[model samples]
Target chain A: MSTKTETRKEEIIRIAAKLFKQKGYSAVTMRDLAKTMGIKAASLYNHIESKQAILQDVILTIAEEFTLGMASIQNQKASSTEQLKALIQLHVRIACHNPDGLAALNSDWMHLEDKLEYYLQLRNDYEANFRHIIERGIENKEIKNVDIEVILFSMLSTLRTLYLWIPKKDRLSEDELSASLTKILIEGINT
Target chain B: MSTKTETRKEEIIRIAAKLFKQKGYSAVTMRDLAKTMGIKAASLYNHIESKQAILQDVILTIAEEFTLGMASIQNQKASSTEQLKALIQLHVRIACHNPDGLAALNSDWMHLEDKLEYYLQLRNDYEANFRHIIERGIENKEIKNVDIEVILFSMLSTLRTLYLWIPKKDRLSEDELSASLTKILIEGINT
Candidate 1:
């Protein structure tokens, strides 16, 4: 594709993510997307294949980014605590940059037609790798002896929903947000 | 209403909550709901007024339960730690009893036409009451000196999403789940 074509495709995906985030994936049609972009549906087809294709691109791209981030964190020699903090920072940065895309990645991935299995594989792999790190932490006495699933679930649930909460705030920088989350999530709130 | 009429209404609302949990509120029609219950659409009207009314009933019923739970916790003369544990137990028990209803309360409340403002008011008040307890904990030095919002957000996010996770498990009793969550959430997982 030409540079102009690629740029338009990117813009279409961006706007589609926003629409999908608001009205959900099943409710937003190609015409709705085109209307939001101030273009005819035919013009939309010129840049994108279909609404499902746009969803596939939006969700898989973010999912792959997370997989790559996890791989990078896992290959490091840092302690589990450091790696977990890096993971929190990773989520904060991604959520800060593309809250809408993150929302789609979380909520609309189920709507990916042909790519659903690939998405679920990546999700399960990402989660397994996360659990491995928590297991290592427990073994090394760097974390508590709580049920690994419980700790993992608590942290993942918070991290997964950051897009809903973080975009509403303007006071905290990314670093401040990550630090506060790391402290509250990693360390107990007990005095 | 006669006992038989009341029982039929409850049965329709129960089945509607299940369908709403699966397909979401907008996608589930009154006809679809009646179909799920093995009845005609006309019979559905005898028990319920409209799809919106059923959604209003499902969501408001669960929302009011949470509100009442929070009120009871607030009235107790317990310490923050004790109050927080009671709050977790309350969520676990509620989610255990009505996972589909809780799911609707979380995801489908936005589709509410007439009761939107009232639902939001109840939600905002619940969160405010929760924050008040955390603020008091911080003031009394019973909890860590983290950002109140961060602590609140971390805990609330997990508690709110429990309906998605808890229903998949069959081994742990409500008391066990509540205790595990309290330990991980309140005490932090740091060894």
Candidate 2:
């Protein structure tokens, strides 16, 4: 695509992400997106084929980032604890950096039917990566013997909620929050 | 209220919940609600003062149910572990029976602003009840020494996702699923 075409596509996707995150998928109209983007309603058709496609692209971008974050950790030969810390840090960082895409991925895409089914599979696949780390930790007796699925679900859910709870200005510096969260995850608040 | 008035209010709340849950809050108009109820649009104003009042009443009902669920556990005399189990069970029950309310409480009401702040506070206070159970568990040595905040966040997040994960029909009965989830949460899958 030409530079102009690529930029327009990015702009559409960006605006769509913000709208979908803020207003929700079902409620946002294509005309609304066009109006927000300062383009004719018909002009949007030239760049993006459908609303679902826009949603798919926004969600796929987030899924890719999450998978990439996990893959980078897996590629390294870190111990289970180190891998888990890396996973949490990367997840929260992506969440804070891209709240719109993150929220769309985590909350809004369920409205997308078949497109969402594809996203769900990708999410499960990514989750399997985390489960693998937790399984390894359990095997090594490094972490507590929690049900892998429940613990994995709990950890992922908690991490996803940072999008809702962590205000942009008040978010603890990444390094400090990572150190604190990592310590809590690996060791219970016992002593 | 008279029996007729009570029935009318429930009917309105039910229709509103369906519309809000499926179509979203902003998209569902009073006309739509009236149409769904098989009544004239203006007729709704008699039963509920306004759309906002309907929203408030629906939210207040859900919040009340949440508090009642929390109280059911709070009223019990048991170990912190037992309280945690009750808390999980109540959460799962509410999520199953009240998926719309769960989503609204978790995601939808961000748009409702100060109007819904009262509802938000009720839910938060209910959550604090759950958090206190975890805190007591840590004090009593029932739970592992994990960061109480992270663990609390994790458990609540995991529970919230039940609205998404639980199927309408399955081999696992609600009781069985709730029991399994409670177990997985209290005892990590080590042994």
Candidate 3:
């Protein structure tokens, strides 16, 4: 694809993610996407195939970003604690940059028809990679000996929902968020 | 209402909450609720007013439970950490006992019609109560002097979504979950 066409596709994906966040995936139609873009429906088809295409593009793009982020973190030489902080920062940065896309990825991923299994695979692999990090931490005594599930669930729950919280808290500098979450999540709130 | 009628109404609400969790508030109907309960629509009405009533009942009951739980915790003479642990236990217990209703409240509370503002007030008041606890904790040096929103958001995000995680983790006993989460959520995860 030409650069201009690729940019238009990216723009369409961006706007569609916002709309999907507002009105859910099932409720949005091609006509709505066209209207939102101020283009004819035919032009939208020029850039994207269907609403499903946009859904896949929006969701898979973020999902792949996470996959790539995790791969990089895995290749790092940091301790598990520092690795976890890096993971937290990864989520915060993504959520800060593309909360609407993240929101769409969260709420509308289930609506993906063909790519559903692939999406779930990416999610499961991500979690397994995360779990391995925690396991390594436990073995090395970097993390406290606790039910790994409890720690995993608590951290994943908070991290997964960052999109919902970050928008409400834009005043928090990204550095502040990354640092504070590192302490609050890893260090326990107790002084 | 008579005792028998009240019991039946409770049954309807319970089933409806389960359905709402599976589907969603907008997709659920009185007809669907009746079908789930193995009763005709007309008979369902004898016990309840409308779909709005069921939603209000399910959500308010859980919301008010948190309100009451917070009130009871506030009445106690304990440290902020203890109070926060009590709050965590309160959420775990509620999520363990009524995961479905809690799920409905988390996701479908926005669909509430007549009671939306009241729900918001209850929610705001609840958050205010929580924030004050954190503020007190920070003042007394029981908690670290981090951004209150970061602590509050991290903790509340986990607590709010317990309903999603508990069912998958029914193997974790209620007492175990409460204690482990207190450690993981409050006590940082590091050694």
Candidate 4:
């Protein structure tokens, strides 16, 4: 695609991400997106082929971003504890900055029709990175060896849910929040 | 209310919970709920005042049950660790039994109107019990002193998410699942 065409596709994808996050996938329509962008429905077709196409692009973009972020941590030379901290920080940062994309992944993931197979695979891979870290931590004696699946699930699920309780205004600043959560995850309250 | 009236109310709540879980609150209508229940829309009013009423009841009932279950644990002679295990087990058991109610709380909770302040308060009290256990555990050197917010959030969100992942034919019984999760939460994988 030409530079101009690529830029337009990017803009369309951004708007669709916002709408999908707020109204859900099934509730949003091609016309609604166009109206928000001050254009006609046919004009949107010039930018993207269909609403599902927009959804596919948006979801793929988010997954790709997450995979890239997590991969960067996995390649690091730190201890498992530091690596886990980095993963948590990166995830929370993405959630803080990319609320639209986060919402799409959390709320609109089920609307992908038959294409969910690919997305689910990507999600499993993403989860596997976390699982690998926990396993390494246990092997290295950094974390307990209680059930690996449960520990991994708790860390990921807890981090993901920050989106629900985090207030737009009063949320912990990146450093403070990460510091607090990391301490809790690593050392229990016993002493 | 008479026994028949109570039975009718329970029936209406059950139907509404199913519809709300399947279609979400905004998409479900009284007519649709009535049709699903094999009753007319007007006939629904004989048992419940409004769709919101039914929703409020469903959520409140779950919240109340959770609180009562936790209270019973508090009254028991178990150690802090055992109490925590019982709490986790009870939560998974409820999720298994009332998957629809759990789904409703997960997805359709924001749709409840202003009249549900009492139910929301009940939720706060229920959460307080979880927090209390963690606090007590911390003081007694039974649990870690990590952020109660993070630990509590992880426990509830992870268990609640069982709605999406837990299958009926799973080899692990609910108690087994809870036992594994509790082990992970209270003890890290360091060993």
Candidate of highest lDDT? 3
TM-score for each of the candidates: 0.91, 0.67, 0.96, 0.75
For model 3, how does the per-residue alpha-carbon lDDT over B1-191 read when each residue is reduced to its tens digit? Answer: 12555688798888899999999988898988888877899999899899999999999999999999999999999999999999999999999988999989988889899899999999999999999999999999999999999999999999998888888887889999999999998889999
CAPRI tier of model 2: incorrect
User: Candidate 3: where is the Cα deviation over 4 Å?
Assistant: A1-6, B1-6
Estimate the lDDT of model 4.
0.77
The docking category that best describes candidate 1 is medium
Model 3 chain B worst lDDT window (10 residues): B1-10
Q: Write the per-residue lDDT of candidate 4 for residues A29-69, one digit (tens) a residue.
A: 99999999898899999878889888888887778887888
- On residues A53-151, what C-alpha lDDT tens digit does candidate 3 reach at each position? 899998999999999999999999999998999999999989888898999999988899999999999999999999999999999999988889888
Off by over 4 Å in 2: A1-60, A70-90, A96-101, A107-121, A127-155, A166-191, B1-8, B42-46, B110-115, B168-170
Which candidate number has the best TM-score? 3
TM-score, model 4, chain B versus true chain B: 0.85
> What is candidate 2's TM-score for chain A?
0.87
Clashing pairs in 4: A143-B189, A143-B190, A144-B188, A144-B189, A144-B190, A145-B189, A188-B144, A188-B145, A189-B144, A189-B145
Model 1's C-alpha root-mean-square deviation from the true structure amounts to 3.4
Q: lDDT of candidate 3 vs native?
A: 0.92
User: Deviation in angstroms for A71 in model 1?
Assistant: 0.7
Residues A21-53 of candidate 1: C-alpha lDDT, one tens digit per residue: 998898999999999989999999888899999
